[model samples]
Target: MGVLESILRKDGRKFMKRKDSDAGEPGRALEELRGSLYSDFHTSDGAKRQQQRLCGPFVAMTFNFIVAVGIIMANKVVMGMVGFNFPIALSLIHYLTSWFLMAIFKALSLLPASPPSKTTPFSSIFLLGAVMALATGLANVSLQHNSVGFYQMAKIAVTPTIVLAEFMLFSKKVSIQKVITLAVVSIGVAVATVTDLEFNVFGACVALAWIVPSAINKILWSNLQQTGNWTALALMWKTSPITIFFFMSLMPLLDPPGVLSFNWNSNNLFAIVISALFGFLLQWSGALALGATSATSHVVLGQFKTCVIMLGGYIFFNSDPGIVSLSGAVVALCGMSFYTYLNLLGSKESATTSNKLLSKQNSFSQKPKTAEDDVKVEVNTLSSV
Candidate 1:
């Protein structure tokens, strides 16, 4: 009887041990599965975030390009082809349309509002507004006087102008490579657009005059963005009203002959409305593009837009873009591409250096001095004394 009891006890123990092992196996397998899923989820999430970061700027740039092209084409049709012939009035219509759109956005709470700046004086805002008005007005006059291709070619100078303004106003230094790139772009533009047969001295003057204010306006916008933490819409809202006021004040001096004498028709009215809408879209998209990317990126995109406009002018306006002009445009675009590559390389190096410094700082901050280390330091100091 004792031997049988021993055998039963031994068998029961073995059975219980096997049951426990079986349960443990499933539990460990479940934990491993959960860990693998968690790791995969994190990996995919990080990849998605990276994609979104790249896609956002790309989308903004593309939108700005399309909108800019549409606006230029529309303006060329209205002011150049349709004989609206009212540059100031046309500019006024643009601002009014922009203001109306902004008002609508504000009412719907779709526009992001920025807090008012205590340090920024009203005069500064007025000055920015005046510059905006003058830049747009002069650009329109230039466009009216020049062929579309020549007008776009003239805009190639804007990049170098901005670079020059930065150097003069902010004491910023550009690299020799960048300077060479700028020279190449300028030379190419001169070759493409500046022909004695097609060039009007007045138009060239208008374009050159437009460059200074445009550069200053961009610098001011960038400054306001960094210092005031203002969004694109907020900046637009603040400046649009002042811009409208300035345009109205200047209308008397700048308006064309017999402002109210032209016969108004549905086709002309439709063209005016379309041009105004395109103008508003141009401003909004341009602001958003600048907000999404840097000024350099904006300028690079501008070069691309100029190329597109130049092509469009050939197709739509029947502008004679000679071999020299086409070659010049290609050269200017290549220089811009080179400049962009250098800028990107510099930015990457700067970011890497910054990251390394940040990591060193974090590591230094993490290591606190222990009591023993403090005692050793004090002892060393006393011994040295």
Candidate 2:
């Protein structure tokens, strides 16, 4: 009986040990499964967040670059090759098409709703739209009168023009480095204009006429976005109608009578329609870039576009902008690039200064208030009283 009782106790102990081991296996498997799931979720979430962070600026820049270059080439073909001599009319078509597209985007919930009228005043929007019309109109006129290379070279003047305008109008101060760079840019543009075989007085005057309005337009666009938190599409939607009105009013005055009699054949229609579509994309992408970046960055992108467009003109359009003109463009580009760098550096310095001030204030607030501080405050209050 003693031996049997000992045997039963030993078997019971063995059975209990086996049961404990079996229970642990399931828990171990469950923990492993949970760890695997957590790792996968962490990896996927990190990748998605990274993509979202990068997508905006990358897409904006790429969109601006491709459409900007393509639109210029397409417009050159339409205006120069297809003999679409009415610059104002062409601009009108572009604005109208853009407005229609914006409407569709609004309906589809792709674009944000227009801001409240009180927040974005009609007068300001109207002014921007009018200036936009004048800027685009003069651009087309300049393109119509000038070779593609010369037109693009003239656009480089806008950077310096913007700098001067800001200083004069808003008391904005630029660094000496930026001033020197802008001077270089101006000299380079003058050299290119002088050397350009295709340069005519009217074309040059029109190109020169374009610079101020263009500068103002860009400044206003940048200001509106940064200060008012305006999205590009929303701003465009509000301003397009004003632009259209300006275009319509200018059409009769500027566009010649032959528009009605001009042949609207399939080829011509197709070319013009395509050019107009590119025009809409140009406005959208340009606004996207300006909003995503800054006026300075936009100008830098424009400088890059200038280089590509000039090269494209030489290659595709058989433009013989002599070695001197090309050299001038190179000088201007180098100057513009330097100016952009200086601006960026200055911005970073300012940002750092502001951050330091904020940190100091935060640190002071976090510290426990001492009796001396309270005494000083009380003293000041009594003194004021």
Candidate 3:
């Protein structure tokens, strides 16, 4: 998966070239779509700003968590009439549709967007994009079998997961504060994971499938974004095509077509179409955030997402979080906060500087001026004097 991430970076140059060329007209539609979603669904105004700032990722994850519950409930109702499970079908359908839409968008980009230098090739990016899609798709699949709150707990687990990834892969040393934080987050996972006892065995197993890629993708996508290798949306959008291809290949072998073919009612259809758009937004925003920061920090901060969703679940369903869940959440949140604070403090810039050493280097690079300019200025000054 890491190698695949490394390979996808090569395609970023090509993707960026396409993005620049299409900035004028044909590209306007997707930009418009992204802008509309950001404004209407993402950005919060007025008093909500602080709420938005405090738990940035939480708002989005809550939206996703709610949608997951909605989809499951909707699927149950719809399946009653259609006599088939849509969730199973959706595991493949969502990717299939999203990728196809992206491919068409890519085609349209060719019409108006200018092409970039030929140095970047398609194969390089295709592999990385494929890795991204696989990671994202399996993560989504985890939600199908797991309850929102349970899945959310697993989501919180991604923090320590990434920390471990960094430690093992990058040889980073852990501090005492960091170790304590990890312990707190681990406790939260225990509370959240233990409660869904009826079917948790399966839910947890599926969630682990997601956790590995989620952590890897977080770290990989972060670096890819830092180096300007790929714009955030393009990485996820491009992979949709490859994801579709892979899903399509595997679905028939695993699930039946009769499972997908359904009685299309207006309401259920609306639900799915809406979910698809949200899915895109979720992936894009997530990629944007990861690309903007260190993956380790990004994952650690993302713990808030699970907290919000768990709280929201309690409100919506009147589901009791109980003592264990509450304690776990607090501990996990504190750990993440402590870890983030230490990292930020350590990275702070110092005021002291020695610019005198730079003076010679600056003087050596200067442009030459005529000596007469000195005489001219001197004569002018004498006349003024």
- Top TM-score prediction, candidate number: 1
- State the lDDT of candidate 1 residue by residue for 1-385, as single tens digits: 9999999999999999999899989988999987765543334333223323543556767888999888877978886777888888899999999999989987875555454466577787788788999888887788778776567666766777787777887787888998888788677766766654355898878877888887777777666654555656677888999899888887776666766877678898899899999988888777766656555567768776766667667879998788787788788788878977887788789999999999999998997999999999999999999
Count: clashes, candidate 1: 0
Judge candidate 1 at residue 142 and give its lDDT: 81
Q: What is candidate 2's lDDT per residue for 77-140, written digit by digit as tens?
A: 8877999889899989888989999889867756654445777677889889999998998887
Q: Which has the better TM-score: candidate 2, or candidate 3?
A: 2
Clashes of 2: 0
Ranking the candidates on TM-score from highest down gives: 1, 2, 3
Q: Write the per-residue lDDT of candidate 3 for residues 194-300, one digit (tens) a residue.
A: 57634466567777777777787777766555543355545556556666676665556434467545766787677666556555555655665665456766665
Worst 10 residues of 3 by lDDT: 110-119
Model 3, runs deviating above 4 Å: 1-84, 87-124, 146-157, 167-176, 198-205, 253-257, 313-319, 350-385
Clashes of each: 0, 0, 4
Give the whole-model CA lDDT for all candidates, comma-separated.
0.76, 0.77, 0.60
* Top lDDT model: 2
Compared to the true structure, candidate 3 yields what TM-score? 0.61
